[model samples]
Target: MAKRRRRYQNRHGNRNKTKYIVIGIVGLVIMITTLALTLLVKNQKITLKAPWTLEKSTRIKTPEETLRTYFSYIETKEYDKMYELINEESKQSVTSEDFIARNQKIYEGIEASNVQIQITQVDDSSELGAAISYDMTLQTAAGEISFPNQAVLTTTKEGNYQYLIAWEDALIFPNLTKTDRVKVSISQPERGAILDRNGNLLAGKGVASSVGIVPGKLNEDPTQDLNQLAELLKVSVESIEKKLSAKWVKDDSFVPIKTISKLTELEQTTRYTSDETLEKRARNDALLSIPGVMISDTQVRSYPLGKAASHLTGYIQQVTAEDLEKHPNEGYLETSVIGRSGMEALYEKELKGINGCEISIVNEEGKTKLVLASLATQDGKDIQLTIDASLQQALYESFAEDKSSSVAMNPYTGEVLALVSTPSFDSNDFVFGMSQELWDSLNEDERMPLYNRFRQKLVPGSSFKPIIAAVGLETGDINPEEDYGNAGLSWQKDASWGNYKVTTLHETSPANLENAIINSDNIYFAKTALKIGSEKLQSELDQLGFNTDIPFEIGLSKSQYANEGDISTEILLADSGYGQGQILVNPVHLAALYSGFANDGNVIKPYLLYQKQVQPQIWLANAFQMENANLIKSAMEQVVSSEHGTGHAAYREDIVLAGKTGTAEIKASKEDKSGTELGWFGIFTSDKEVDKPILLMNMVEDVKERGGSGYVVRKDKEILDQYFGTQQ
Candidate 1:
């Protein structure tokens, strides 16, 4: 029985062991599960990432290829597989076709064998967005070119970087050779012919037979060589030498020589060159051969009209070092042609074409071995202007005797028909390099031909009366028949000119807006302007294009707005009444202001270009029809057609002409009483039943003899009457 009990106890122990094993297994499983949970939770917490961080940085191998491909697609000139990858934002600015054409030259110049690019830096901007910098090396058969450039780009969702945009060289590049060299020639356009409104050539490129030398080709001293060259050209040796050394930096072995100068007249400089062969040959041997120079063909600038449109057309001048630095991408060289002013400066891109190059081989001995391929230089486009040459000549002839200015505009289109400023100088002076004496003489002249008097400042005087009168009628301050007694005296209280009595130029009493305008009665208009007050009158004038500068293509003068708030009422009334006290004007201002009467009441934006259209029944039929323009025209008609109108001298029944005259005072001194007067006339004419009118503004300045008189502007009536004829 004891044995049985022991056996039973052993069995019990075994059962207990089995129970512990089960518990151990269960605990181990629970611990392992807990650890795994902890590890998973920790990993999740550590790996949290931002949304933007999902993107990957990318690099393009061939950046120029990317740009060319993209530009082609952007320009819409080619259907390429790469175009599908364009950025969304860039599509808005230009069409694919235009984009291709714009970059046509740039792409054509690139060759796969010559391309080498070095990735510089990746940059981010807060405003301008992302961009990448690059250093490029272009190795062509002729030579190797290196440039630093940048491309603006954006990263895509797919993590690829592409070319967004690029730019060309901004600073002027140094010549390939290290020597003093020059190639002087004239510039001509082959695309379109430039002509005046009268069909006369204003500017066009003409060929001049020329010869130039590479500095290395010269055998003798540059100075002595230049001296010999100057003697051949019949110009001062100093001038020729100065031009040769103008922008040159001295270098070893290579000195440029220009043996044959530009043709003064295209009529066969061959005679000039041929006649002086022995002399030129001696100079060439003495000056050029020492340096191992080479001959080259060059371009130049020409002004066919010479002095006719000098100020208007402007002229070309040598590019300064500073200019080259500023416009590095301009591809300007020492011998490059630049438009200094006028239309040349205005449309420089159109007037300047891409420069091409040649790929020729040079032997180890520094000799050109074989003829190589070449990319010809492009000619600039022609420019046409609105100037009527005949009319401009006539106006110039008339105003040549004195300091005067005239402007004529097409009423319907606002195209300037003719603009003339007297005492003009030859534009050729700048091109040929004016002598110090001639330049000094022009500068010393009191008339100041360089000043565009048409744009000069002046007080409108009585010409302000017509504008004020129109404002009075428009704003209901005065009626057409409203009577105003001038009393031939002061109109504003405390006015500086109060003590001085005004005289009535015409026989009239207590006149209305009609009579006051006709006689140019200072008192009547002063009272009218005062009655209207500064705010009301200013508002009206501002609407009439008086306070603001009108939009026009050419450079314009700013119209002076009186500081009515700061000045006294008496001053305002006196100055504002006669158009003298606070306001300022120029020829352009008068012409535009007078247009209000010519166009009825509508104030249209003045323009010079005519938008050409097709099909007469469509847009062409309503091209120039303006509605509100008539309101201003009706008022101007009364200023000339009415019996008491101020511009009766301009009245022409056949043409339906109307205008106003003004004479402003120019104070001489504080105590001394000698001063000048300015004369002005603004006219608008209708030749027949028309959609628009013809406008003219004529001004004569510094008329000292007619001091403080109202008749100065009126004196032009005889000329106007003769030129325009009696319409009535």
Candidate 2:
């Protein structure tokens, strides 16, 4: 014990009190300061360079955690963070700035979306690094892409993850390299053609002259030259100037002003000319001689029949942004065109061909490294319609300076021969890009040149008598010899609780069903409808295609027997019998119903798609009894053949003709005289031969003072004469 005490005292004494204590304190303080500096540098709280630099501890705990963090940064588009997660060798190969820009361009260019990454496997046994296998999927403009990939994580000097991404271009996309290029090549498809029954072009591609001007090549004062050019092109000088000074116009650019259809010999001679030449060709040379005015041949949508077939073919316009959004992945581009109206719109799928798409990787030598996706180009289909171009033109020209709608068909075959709407505009103008002023004029015109009247429902007036006559005969309401029409210009079915009276233009005695139909006796048919009763009347009309849309390729307003499908009053039902009440009929549908007379009471459904051999399709069977339909057909034939017949003007000595006439009064009341009349004339051949017989129905507006139904009858005769003459 004494030796231990002595040793301890000696050790304490050797310290020399304050001197040894001061030395120990200074050493302890130096050690603590060194430890703090090392920690600060390691945590990045303080930056030290060269000999004093310290490696940071791993912030990411495990290889799996590191993988999640790396991918999470990518999902969040933290580009700088993504670059930082790579290993030293990868960083040396691709700088942080290059890596970020490269990824951003590729992703945005492809319109990448719906990114999803799933880790499939991970291997961290190697002391050198860790490896992760994953599946990735992303959507692109062309299609969806999915691939399996692997990411190698090299061992890092610092951080808890102990590994970093060994980055390469292949990590961004499967089989991609730094020197490779991603390309998307799109091939445009040619639009389809619209052809007539005989393979005539209704809407197709043809060469036209595109007129433009190069600003730098113009004279110092180009007003006079531009004025002359405008006059020849039928455009305003201001429009030419505006196009020349467009925002994208350059000194060498050819700023287009107008596209003029080539006045080829094949085109129908236009109106306002000797025999309707499109335009005066004498000015074309003068237009070309003007300074800076240049004409180039360009392909455009051609309209051969011009105004004759414009309403049937419709037009196409540039694809709108809204269309692109609504039809994403439909293979549409900015350069695409879309059908806007008429048969073009109804058969858009058959007209808009599929475009080609190619997504591939190209190497430095511009050789394809890999074809990611490829689709072959598909051209649009040619749509053929059952229309006779000659008949269409003849029908259109029949309504010169008149507002009219006409439909011609083969009564037995139900093949529509022609559909004509007068006061029409050139559809080619729309395809060439319509001017705002021209468009305004069409909309603001009181005549309504843009109106598609064939698709509209109009009052049939006396033309509806044949249908009522059929109804009466089929239901045993009236006999052909029994007289229902009285000898008076007007008659009333009872008092009807009002002063309304059924009036006829011509009074005849013994106005039986056949005679009533021939003279269009309003009271006789009115009484017949009352005898049929409202419920039965509606049912008959329904069977005849009222209140239902016609099964056709193009959309037309449905025919209606009443405003809301019910004839609630006797007066209403009586008025409807003469086609004057709430009854309205589409020209096409009415024509189809009239076809039943020639088809033995079977209403044949009309079709527009061309077929080599036509087989009649029944729309309504037993619409009328065979004898009743034949009786109506016989009366219509007499109406044209007999001297007292309203359609006597349409009579021809060489061929048998049948017809019915209607004059619809658009009046506020029964006594109103200051109203326009819609004249209707339905004519067809009743010959026993029955080969290629044509049934034509035409309607003319504002015919009240212009000769009533006679005006329509005369026009119908002229059209029929020409059509039949051609057939002969």
Candidate 3:
């Protein structure tokens, strides 16, 4: 019985052991499942959180997100965050110091405002890494630059998952290695050429020799070499040093010291067979003998006619810091040259073309590895003007150093044939930089060489007689055929204006309309003004463009007919009729007025551009009736054709010239008892072959003799003879 009981107990014990093992297995399974579910929920792979829980969570970012964050840090210049994302292995290979140095070198001297970067897309084709495509834009002083690039990023395992930028020199820029760098090279465009009416070159580009220095390549101290060069070039040593100290100048930069147009103009003398040989030898000597000097061929602005067209063509000067500030983002550099005045300034944009550039990848040794991209520069457009070069030269020579101004125009079209302002300057001096002494001399000269006399105002004197005659005929105040008579050498308005008599140049008392114009009788026109009344005279002047600014390309001072609140008394009205008392005019204005009479009372707008066909603009379509215009023309013709005409000096039997002359007294001061006279003359001729009559006006300041008008009349004949080829 004992044996049987022991067997039963052993069997029970065995059963109990099996039950405990199963319970332990179930408990282990429950714990394992709960931990797995908690991990899944934390990673956002599953939503198993309690319903009452308010907190939200997210999974580890993908490779694309990692790359986006990295680029965001780069854009904001958060270098620390960017560095933290670099792979540990890459950090070990390249220290943070080395990485930062490489980046700084790539972006050296670039302003943050001038740089822009964009991440376009991430190509995650591989499980271990992804490729990032981006576009980078940089605005440099030279120009704008844009390029496409790429970077590589690799993944790593952390608490969940994260990414690390696969570090390589190429990651910064595609195909850029540790030993490679980027370089920018500039190519300047050729400036535009200025041409005359006949396609004659006025201002254009010419070759010049520029002496420069490569500071890094110098064999000796720059100070000694620069001193020797300065002595040879006749420049100050301090000037050379200052040029070398420019912001753009560097150890590897080519700093230009001076430029010379002609080899013969150099101070040093070296015998050679020809000019070409001499220039070659000089260039060689400058490059080889000087320790730091380098000779190069450069472009310069050339004025072919020099002083003859200085005032018209003006000059170009180097761009200043002020110019860059005023015109930000205009792509202007320190090396830029800009037009300072005249047509050059007016057409600067047209004359300055688009610049181009070359981007290259250079090695650590500064050797060009590859040409990344290139763009060719575009040349500026050429400008053609209406001025006849030969005619301009003739007019300039005719002045012969006299302080005078003149204008010759076609009446029907208002095409200015010759515009001359004497005592001109050499534009080339301004181009290369005029010396201080020379500039002071020019500025201090009493003749005012820089002043544009063609735009200046002067008293019209009796040259305005024809316009008054037109007013009389148009107003019906006087009959052209009737004899109004000179009245006398002097006349006054009753006794109230006693001792205020207006005198004339006439020696006779009785004068007809034709004779009054021929004699330029001031008394007759003064009396005629009284008949028409002062109010009508003012209205007539207003209709004739007085008290208005001349609409010209260049600035012009407004011409005046009367003071702002002038009293129109009999004495004042008398003076007004004779072209005195606040009656001021410019050559251009007078030319336009005279042109009206020649064009059947239509005033044409003057223009200087001839590249296209320009239609004539009529300032006044009908300034007077056709009969009245014809009557004035006939009377003016008699002023030259008539034997006793005051403008007899301008008489030409074969050409049939018509003109008027005046000698205006300009008071030295308001209190001065005596004053100097200004000479004036105007002439025109109608030729059948020419579509419009050619009109000319001359003005000479401070004429010594009261008979100065006669001198001007002779000059008018000479100019006409030269223009029309010696009329028989």
Maximum-TM-score candidate:
2
What is the C-alpha lDDT profile of model 3 across 126-225, one tens digit per residue?
Answer: 8887776667665443346567777677777753336677778776557678778777676777889989888898899876677888877876557777
Highest-lDDT candidate: 2
lDDT of 3: 0.74
Worst 10 contiguous positions by lDDT, candidate 1: 45-54
TM-score of 2: 0.80
> What does candidate 2's lDDT look like per residue over 130-209, in tens digits?
88787777677556777888888878766445678888888768899889978888898888999999998988898887
Off by over 4 Å in 2: 1-123, 132-150, 154-166, 172-175, 220-253, 263-283, 363-371, 496-498, 687-689, 726-728
What ranking of all candidate models by lDDT puts the best one first? 2, 3, 1
Worst 10 residues of 2 by lDDT: 45-54
Per residue, candidate 1 scores C-alpha lDDT tens digits across 397-481 of: 7667667788877654556767778788866556555666778889999988777776666677777776676677666777667
Residue 238 lDDT in candidate 3: 90
Evaluate residue 320 in candidate 1 and report its C-alpha lDDT on the 0 to 100 scale. Answer: 83
Clashing pairs in 2: 58-159, 58-160, 269-276, 270-276, 270-277
